[model samples]
Target chain A: MNEPYFREAEERFCELLKAYLPYEDAYQELYKTEVNNLPLYGYGVKGFTLSMIEAIMNITNNKGDLKLVEGALAIGREILGKPVELLEDVESTLKSLNGDYRLVMATKGDLLDQERKLLKSGLAKYFHHIEIMSNKNKEDFQKLINHLDCAPEEFMMVGNSLKSDILPVLQIGGNAVYVPYHITWEHEKIDHHITHDHFHQVETIKEILPFLKSQSYLTKETLK
Target chain B: MNEPYFREAEERFCELLKAYLPYEDAYQELYKTEVNNLPLYGYGVKGFTLSMIEAIMNITNNKGDLKLVEGALAIGREILGKPVELLEDVESTLKSLNGDYRLVMATKGDLLDQERKLLKSGLAKYFHHIEIMSNKNKEDFQKLINHLDCAPEEFMMVGNSLKSDILPVLQIGGNAVYVPYHITWEHEKIDHHITHDHFHQVETIKEILPFLKSQSYLTKETLK
Candidate 1:
């Protein structure tokens, strides 16, 4: 994905997640994991793990086959009592898939809110796997690399902030796209240098979509 | 003056100035006469002479106690109407009146558009003496210093660009507060070395009001 557009989308998605998720701890856990790279403590880990299980269960359904993703299709109808479509209007924007490109998300804490929301929201159908962890240091990032079975250069990490999204990916020689957020909490502060030459700065999210589609390494035709 | 706050206000004021005066040639001329050491062209010299006439006319009100000064002010007023408000605003913001300080404007043309507007806008009440120039270069800047009878250290330059505002001021051993505009035109490109430094960035116009009010060389209390 183009760096600017992906960053914008990720920022918007995070904002929506904050509104939908209950409890202060959920927000704290999410921020720590996604923004601060801090470890998830006792309840946070369990809560996150449970949310992921809920998401997976919702995806499987009783039919035992995964359906192609549709925007805004709510998963976990049995528990939530209704289908919730979180992905909304942007469904048609996603590129058509071929099996060559595997989609994955590396997040801190156990998969909880985002995973469940993604499946419930019908966004989970696009990704093959999601990795949720309590830590996002060098070791965890390396583990993610191994799990994905992809080289650093081959994968592109997209997120908000130069501290979290850009620094680690750049350290590993991976391409990273940063989307600056309008609002950042105090806890998200991380010591990171943002030299003009090191990273690309962009104002909006949609600008990156064309770039992502153009990159051959992430495209189905190139993979085949 | 509080450096940070003054910097912010100076930036805001510069942004407004750029919007009202967007031509590159005018900006170059203004810079050449006001900051850079260079000689004024025919129209620029005429404009400067006319401005001196207007200043004298304002003091003499045509009754000719200072006929030479009044004559100069009349010619200056004929060339530049009320744009002098820009200078008056700066004068009103100065913190004290102990030393001679000159008003230098970096613009891109031979006419004093900003100076005329300030006078016509009913803002002239705040300023006593004014100098208007369309072209500013190193030599013109030196002439301005001589006209004001002050050393470069005792002087300050307020403007919007690192290339035009901060760099030249620092080169002359003068303090400068840069107020960056939200959008910059293609013609205003600066050397990469100047913008890379964090010391020069400012965001707002109101922040510098207090800083100017605190300066010992200019009197803010008397200005109002």
Candidate 2:
């Protein structure tokens, strides 16, 4: 879900918001409200951006400022259009394990927009299958596993959001790697962190290679 | 799509809003704003309801009032969860044409939400395929036709929205029956009227029977 590059998008979204509002913590408030209301509105760059702007306009007492809101939305479109920078060593890393693992990019967002981003990301060639889910709850993960025809123990989930990436996968009896981003959405933050045998935290995505090398599932034939 | 009974759903949404804000034209304002912002926020009762509430809160200058907004969103969840009643003779009409034509339920909204409604409607038995698209435009329709392995002329689209249902099908050279609902979304209204040889307008879903019977493609073998 994080794709190792979405944090930059989030940072850019916040930068764009700063141009319209003078509030220093506008992004923080925006993230909190967007997460809280995500179940109601669902997920997408467009909906999330609109929600963020609506929150900012309300807090700043600029509710009637339609033009300002439009400006903010336009910025959101720009953010979505912005090229996603692949994290350091991401391409080479994924390419190395491409055949060794059934790399499926499971992401959730607006269908059209997410597809566009995946195309723009230029990293689509490394994965076996791509999923753009409407929601990433436990039910969604179960469906994905079923579609892949793999047992939960064989799946290795990796992403930046604890709520979307780590928790649900672990709850479904799958393995997961949590790569913490510098700036995370408040809503994705978990109050109670679980300690599990299959759950591993790494400083960077590259660390997952060594972790996988230690797994019995990684065979030399597939690694070739 | 309206599914015939969405007007009642819209009416229910408006009624819920009236409890929080005493504005006579609130629903109208809500609908207008919603249509205008549909492209930006995308569609689905949840997103639309959230946007409408955001608009009301903005106009009423109750920006920090999160509880009222939450209440409104809850109403939106109810709208999505509400049972959709088919138009008069809709099921029978569709059932009659069910085999004669490759009946595909093509509507746009949140994927999971739309699927839930389709399953709940118990109308899933009639259609050969059901598509809940992110957006209903020429390209989207083209993709659906391609997937169905049918030519544009072979497809007959029956839906309520002109913006989504009628125009695109006509533009793609598909036959279409316009079954106008009593309340149409403002965004779905077309600026210019279309007169095409393949297009027919009927007051109810039942009326489509005679129109389809007139078509040479409606053979006894296919119908049986």
Candidate 3:
């Protein structure tokens, strides 16, 4: 996983929300309306979707009925023309991979904007499927494994986080390769559960090719 | 910056060391040595040199006498060997760069083994100089900066640990591009001082090229 997605999403949402309403006022109102169950009287569908996604992503802990108010505010902000900077290299890196592996993206927040960006950049074709999950838990792992119909040993989770992708995959008996992201968020804590043999952490995503080549299952035909 | 070096060095040193000493006896002798006192005994000039390199690279915590001892033991176990595995790739990457910049290699520990390897592998020509220090601290930084006669801002420190490379460089107003090593030894603590700045916490050495290029400081003429 890359840092740009979450950082950009948060920034875009914050900027969009701030434009339409006073930042603090909007935060309070959204909190009361969506999270506090004060009734979202004037909010539209977009507002509701954003609130829900924010809640799922755990950005807004259920402090009150206003729990998802932050989400609604973010959604409103995103819709009002906030510029979310796209990661320029992401598409290029994805395009250059020579492997036949499916890309199931696991992210921590609402990815509607990101999904569209991928499509626009023509990177949607490379992935067999896409998944933007709020968390990396047993349920998410099982869902991913079932989707591929592959055993844990056969599956490899590649991401920039050892706390998220690597640890979860290792816990579920799957292989994981960590490509450390340049910018790590404050919330992504190091998993203390990580054993020495848990996962292979490499510096770049490109390193994955050589690692895969080392594995017996990755055939030249499949990789090509 | 990569695990292969330590692994290879460990292996090569062990193979060569074993030819001269019995493995079990070496282990018994090595285990009794103190961690901070590694360079006291000559395990093998090459083995000790590589061990020093590994130690300085922050790959292992065994310092002084114990570093050589454990390194010898590890070599005897066949877990580490001369980093022949990475020689081709390292050479290839170096070649791909087309001698764009003078490589100033700064490594922790003693420099003899690595120097020998570099010379043998024909990588010595690419580097303008190589300095091996027990630790990268204020003293070492000042010395290198003075020797190069370059401003702190003009130089970039590329290495594995944040505690060592990034923080010290940043403290002295020099830029640091961190290429995280594959395996972080237990001693390399996460620097609590790291601020949430993307410009500072570099995940790859390649990031520096573009950054330097943006400033017109990485031109062929400047490097030469």
In order, the B-chain TM-scores come to 0.45, 0.82, 0.58
Listed models, DockQ each = 0.00, 0.15, 0.01
Task: Write model 1 residue lDDT over B1-224, tens digit each, in one string.
Answer: 11232233223323323423444433343334333211212223232432232222233343323324323323333433322323233444542322333333344332223333444555444443344432334555565566556676666666676655566666766666677764543335575755322134446544466556565554433222
Candidate 3 lDDT score at position A222: 39
Which candidate has the top score in TM-score? 2
Error of 2 at A218 (Å): 6.4
lDDT-sorted candidate list, best first? 2, 3, 1
Alpha carbon lDDT at B105, candidate 2: 84
lDDT of 1 by residue, A7-108 (tens): 333343234344344444434444444332122121122222223322322333322111211111122112222334433223443334415556566654
TM-scores, each model vs. reference: 0.30, 0.62, 0.34
Clashing pairs for model 2 are none
How far residue B23's Cα lies from its native spot in candidate 3, in Å, is: 89
Give the winner by TM-score: 2 or 3. Answer: 2
Best by DockQ: 2
Candidate 2 residue lDDT tens string, A68-98? 4444555565655666667787788898888
Full-model lDDT, candidate 2:
0.70
What part of the reference interface contacts, as a 0 to 1 fraction, does candidate 2 reproduce? 0.13
